[model samples]
Target chain A: MFEVENLTKKYDGFTLDGVSFKIERGYITGFIGANGAGKSTTLRSMLGVIKPDSGKVRAFGLDFEKNEQEIKNRIAFSSGAFDYYSHERADRVAKYYSNFFAKWDNEKYEHYKKVFSLDGKKKVRDFSAGMKVKFSLALALSHGAELFVFDEPTSGLDPIARDEMLTIFQDIVADGQKSVLYSTHITSDLDKCADYILFIHEGKIILDGTKEDIISEHTIVYGEKEQAATVKEKAIGIKENAYSFSALMKKSDAHSLSLTQEIPNLEDIMVYYSKGGKR
Target chain B: MSKNLKRRGTLCAILKKELFLATPLPFYLFALLGLMTAIPSYPIIVGIGYVALAIFNSDGFRRSNRDVEFTCTLPVERKDVVTSKTIFVVVIELLTLVFGVVGALLSVFLSSPNGNVVGLDPNLTFFGVAFSCFGVFNICYIPGYFKTGYKSGIPVLKGTIALLLVYSLVETAVNVVPRFNVIFDSLWGDFVFARAIVLVVGVIAYIILTVVANRIAQKRFEKVSL
Candidate 1:
């Protein structure tokens, strides 16, 4: 339901080069990258928070510039921080926020407020970090938003809170009509619920596919330090210790390399890919 | 057209949010100082300064509150964001001017009839001067703050300097020129009724400059990377 085309932004020393991705409907797309990997930059550019040097973002079949108000009405976005009107209560903020969108559902808002166990009268600044994320999600969901775009919503949350966030995301899409695109360095949450994965390294999109396809396409190769070369020759990226080594290579390449191969997780992929450093 | 109505709806909703949500209670408390115009022997222009300082200080609040970042998530355009903010500032300024008017009327009875020996008298001309000073502040601070969308200290500093300069120059000219007293003279004396003319021109200038400032702020803010 959302697409970014050739998004490029430049700064003094960094550039988001030809970044592109498409998020499918009814699935959670986890945009994973290290900090300063241009994840926020890309998302900001797409959302028009920052004008891109040059790019196009289409959402729900409408051009962002031409139909910003209409499109924004249909979409809900947050950085997962309840920093807007921070001095106000959630109930007060909701009253103000609901006016901006035609699809705002007060009953649904009440429902989520109860589901999240949010204190309506308390000031948002008093809430803990996890509570803030939950508050943001409740607001996003109450608006009957078809697409939810969040930036690092799970960061700084406890493991149980993160798991709750993942479940909320899963429940959001289980109906097979909604879509979510959340960017984060935290992959453990995604491991539980994300269906699609878009891995960004530096400014470019390095990997984009289904979670299963991406995990299955790569394997971890490891042995004694002396045999590092066997994996290094065919490996895309490798890390070595004094006594042993682990490298990442395509499943096909690892099979032919005749080295011990193991299945990889999202974190392993991020670790090995990031070793390449700034491109 | 329905498109125009839709656009107006968004603007009105955002304006409401700005006044009720975005703007803080401290802003209203500071505006109460606009009543300082009633203080006898005071420059009365200081009341306008109160409003200007409040406007400048609110920029710091906007930065800390992350108003730009929060507004970007709403169902509004970049232009809408800046437009609503400009309107909010001007509305508070107008309210302050309202208080200044009441105080000026009271000053007519409470202060010296020949006008204060201090600076400018809190007369009809004072409102004109007030409007002009506020206009100068709008020109400086609007574009200045919107240019960065984050930094406000330096912008407010520059705006304050400009505001003070305008206040001093105008007050000094009226007090020292001797011939420009026609501005404070009889309603129909000469120069096509000087007091009325000054009031009309000052109000118009304030309106025009505010419109220009809003336009400039909107354009600059559109380029900001929030």
Candidate 2:
């Protein structure tokens, strides 16, 4: 449903160079990156929020620049910042947003408000961080959006709220018609809900594939320092300590070495890659 | 709805949100300060009200941080955002002008039976000066605010300085230069034709400023990152 090609944007100290990715319908694509890794910049460029120096972003098969309003009308973008209408009451904000969206469902808005336990009369600034995220999600879901782009929606939420958000996201894409492109530093949230993972570090896409494929292909091997040294050249990302070390290698590579292999989760992979991965 | 109609709806929505976020304090303050026009020599008080309104209006994006969400997430185009804000500024300036005129009329009625004051008539000149002030201020403020979003301090400062300089230059010409004073008096002091000419020129300048401001703001805002 969304495609970004060679998206490049330059700033004072950082540049997002040739970043490209795509998200299909009916799946949650997790955009994972460390802080200042150009995740938000890439998303903003895709949304036509920040114009890229040169590149193209297509949404729903339409060029974003040429059909910006039409494309935006069909997508709902939510962020944890909640900077849209901080001073207005929740209901008033809903009313204001409803005017722009053609398919805005007031009934759905009321349903989500009750489900999220959002008080319509309260100013947005008064809401807790978790409440603010929930309110943003509620707005995103009420507009009949086919694609939901959420930036750090679960960043500051408690464990329970994060789980609830993941469940909600799962439900959103269950029908195989809607999709979500979620960007966050929290890899655990993706473990619970994402179908595809796009890993970015230092403005480059280091990994992009199905979650199952990525988890199955990479294995974390633990060994003494000497064994780690022998495998250092072949391992993708390596971490060392005083007496022992662990390295991430493909399951195929580990099978031939006769080393102890531990199943690597999303966090383990991201941690290793972010720490010392070359690619 | 038609695409143009939908875009208009979006613009209206944006305008509504801006007005709501622009809190009523500035309007109240303008009204209170506008009462200064009751005294003839303090007509500059009305100008102060206009300047204050311009500053506060330009500060709206920074005060609320609305530009980020508006530019990034909302479905509206950057041009629409600029257009709606330009319309809002014009509307507010017009309201300030109306209030200033009302206050001047009230002062005239109370001061004398013939509705004449000791100094300037405070009718055409008041609008002329007010519109000119808005034109100059917005010519500076809008493009800067659009370029940098909330970091428009330099532009607003320059605009204010430009405003003061223009007024000072005009004041100096009327006071220091004798031949200029005679011509200024002929045009501004009593001739209805000359006053109408000034009003027309002010209106034209205001329109040109609004158009130019919107164009520059749209271009700059389109390039600005959230």
Instruction: Tell me the native contact fraction for each prediction.
Output: 0.82, 0.70
Candidate 1, residues A1-279: lDDT per residue as tens digits?
888999999999889999988989999999999999988888878888888999888989999889888888888888766777678898998898888887888999999999999998989898889989999988899988999999999898899998988999999999989999999988988888899999998899999999999999999987888898666666777887789888888897777676678999999899888984221
Sequence-dependent TM-score of model 2: 0.93
Q: All candidates' TM-scores? A: 0.95, 0.93
Q: What level of docking quality does candidate 2 show?
A: medium
Identify the leading candidate in terms of DockQ.
1
TM-score for chain A, prediction 2: 0.96
Cα lDDT tens digits, model 1, B5-112, are 878988888898888787778786777667877787766677777776776677667777787788887888778888888888788888888888887777667776
lDDT of 1 at A251: 91
Per-prediction DockQ, in order?
0.79, 0.62
Instruction: Give me the TM-scores of chain B across the candidates.
Output: 0.90, 0.81
Residue-wise C-alpha lDDT for candidate 2, range B7-106, written one tens digit per residue: 7888887777666554434543454455555564443434444554555554763356565455457888888877876776677667666666776667
Question: What's the interface RMS deviation of candidate 2?
Answer: 2.1
Listed per model in order, the count of residue pairs whose N, CA or C atoms clash below 3 Å is 0, 0
